[model samples]
Target: MSSERPKLPIEAVELYNEFIHGGMSRRAFMTRVQGLAVAGLGATAVIEALMPNYALGQQISKTDDRIKTSYETIPSPKGNGTIKGYFVRPVSADSRSEKPSKLPGILVVHENRGLNPHIEDIARRVALSNFMAFAPDGLTSQGGFPGDDYKGGLLFNKIDKAKMMEDMQAAAEWLKARPDCTGKIGVTGFCYGGSVSNNLAARMGADLAAAVPFYGGVPPDAEIPKIKAAVLVHHGELDKNAAASYPAYDKALTAAGVAHEGYIYPNAVHGFNCDATPERYNKAAADLAWGRTIDWFNKYTRA
Candidate 1:
């Protein structure tokens, strides 16, 4: 699909970074980028390259008979109002029980995009793996997910970071304490969600058994010692900032005596694990990273 999207030059990448960091307005960026196309650099191709193809986002379908699903609203004691999310767990085809077999729990955090269909799909995939998965919508206080075209930055800006963290902590603990859970909880996230995973893992410490952060930022070196969960970090070699942070994070993790593993997929860029963006997705890298993530969770979060 991205056959026409040429590899971007350093200049274009810098402009994108500036835009994401809020240093440039969208209008200014677009106007400048149009000049790139005029200059024969394929600017529109660059934007299309970053567009998410929701059709290819999820690995599993919601209607699969192998999984039981529900929408739940749970109270967040963290003063972030109520939390709402999609919950799923695998079921035996032959069993008619309302309650499925007890399994480990996983918190599937979404990208900066709130809890969209992709995340719901991810929850199902986790359930297929025989774990109970719950994906809380951080936009819960703002009425939850805001339909298909919701801009994440809008809801994100309205949220208080501390409140969001507290709410997630509540969600994790709630999932763990469920009668259907084995009490072990794990977390895995991509991009913004990945950064949250790292932050949550450090904050929750031993309470969170495992964390897999896909192309996410690491905590400050000084904060590394606070993390107790066994971590597996997947990074894209072409994501300069993320790639640069790996060695320092690895060193800090080692020094802090944390159990961890890290991988940098060659030639991949940020969001490489997300199959929705054809231009950025690296199937081989995504598959390898996903396998490692599931294996890491199985090893560390098993009952």
Candidate 2:
């Protein structure tokens, strides 16, 4: 966690997490915050501070000359029919070249709130790392993210989980088949996206080379043996729900002979990798997990 900003109470942060995760209504969340107000911080201030700051979390600018970006809509016959996404790639992978070198493709999945600015920025970061990245909006059928996480969460819940999986599968297949992408592909995601990463590994089989899920849920034991991708799981130590899943997940992977690794960062909480929410972002954990993610992708996807 960054010390530059005022630290928020852990209880309040936990309540906010629960609210965003659909454990409570917005009105209830607000009422609860009012009770947790401390010196120099009112309910309003706490709520505002807990909300994501997209600008501050953006590590790569959309206009940065190093990367090329575009919006693409791909057919998802099994899903909502069509899905839109933010696509990014290194400038060197531009199609204009006589024959651009094909690069590994990365499917960047966002949290429960659709493809928000922070996730778009993550795609840009992946592009700068020498891989082509695509991040699809799960709420595409609902008019996308709506530019507000609270509303986005509501919209996300309305989406059919099975259809959303198909939509992500479509995005991954589309990226893998692109002229500028190598046949190998990897997936990485945060929170809700993290679970998608894990599930995609099991579903895509040979089509997926690697999967890095940050604080995501574990797939069922029966699905474990189907995973062909090398898996890297990241969990925050204090994120009880996700942390508790790690041991069982790790054991299942080992029993299934799946290549995998799991790490629980000390003192971190759920959503620790999301810098957009300063109240919960753990810089040290996020940085370490990110570095390991890149290495895992390079090792598995680039091979």
Candidate 3:
């Protein structure tokens, strides 16, 4: 089967992005979708095409023998009382006689829609790359993801933003302290998770070895000097709302003497790295960005 995503109208994709990111109401999104409908492709069809297809984006299967996965709950006194995450690690090469070596850790943060299947798959991919991965559910305090992006987004909004950040920090600390970890940690997240990654880079200081925030918001100017981690930033050329702040952010990082780099992928839009959302996934950009991400982590967080 061909892996190419279907061609979609840019307007429809942007509308969907806005809706999912809380910029547009569902009623407004439906109305806009109706206006964008055309022959054979009604509003319903357009919505279906734009919605996330988790199966399409899953590069690794849960049953894959190369990795072992589990759910873990860690204390988060500063945020939610407890947070649960999907933890994954590469299986030992000599499963019959040897234990896996301690590995560098990567915290895989999700978008506003909690820890969905796509994010779990991402954690698995991190494990395949020879790192331990943990993806905490931002909505864990609200009964978890509710199994749908739209609903997940709603639940995420209910979470106290400050508390959410605290939960992520607690997760990072927990992951780094794990016996299987090498005491070095990196973070990579998309959309909301991307923002969290950047924030954690600032808040965790020397505790964070690296951070890769894809189309995430930049930290405040004051927070810039506090970042001790090597940072790699990714932005989509067409995601003007998010990309607009990159220049200033890059300049601030430079002035702070922070180690960092940034890239803007041409012809890409918000969520371009997310293959689950076919309308927005830019394969070339995603591939290039992923390659850079792994390299950055290895350079900074390798045990």
Best by TM-score: 2
The alpha-carbon RMSD values of the candidates against the true structure, listed in the order shown, are 2.9, 2.0, 2.2
Clashes of 3: 0
User: TM-score of each candidate?
Assistant: 0.88, 0.97, 0.96
**Pairs clashing within candidate 2:** none
What is the C-alpha local distance difference test score of candidate 1? 0.80
The sequence of per-residue lDDT tens digits that candidate 3 reaches over residues 181-286 is 8999999999999999999999999999999999999888899899999999999999998988899999999999999999999999999999998889999999
Q: List the residue pairs that clash in candidate 3.
A: none
Candidate 3: Cα lDDT at 98? 56
For candidate 1, list the clashing residue pairs, or say none: none
lDDT string, candidate 1, 1-303, tens digits: 555535655456556545554566678977776666433346667765555667778678778889889998889987497888899988784335775567889999887658888778878888888889999988888777776433665676688878987878788888989998888999998877788788888888888899999888887667789999999999988888888998989999999999999999998877777677665678999989988988998999993
Off by over 4 Å in 3: 1-6, 37-39, 94-99
lDDT value, residue 175 of candidate 3: 97
lDDT, residue 181, candidate 3: 89
**Candidate 2 lDDT by residue in tens digits, 229-270:** 999999999899899999889888998888999999999999
The alpha-carbon deviation from the true structure for residue 159 of candidate 2, after best TM-score superposition, in angstroms, is 1.1
**Of candidates 3 and 1, the better by lDDT:** 3
Q: Candidate 2, TM-score vs. the true structure?
A: 0.97
Ranked by TM-score from best down, the candidates are 2, 3, 1
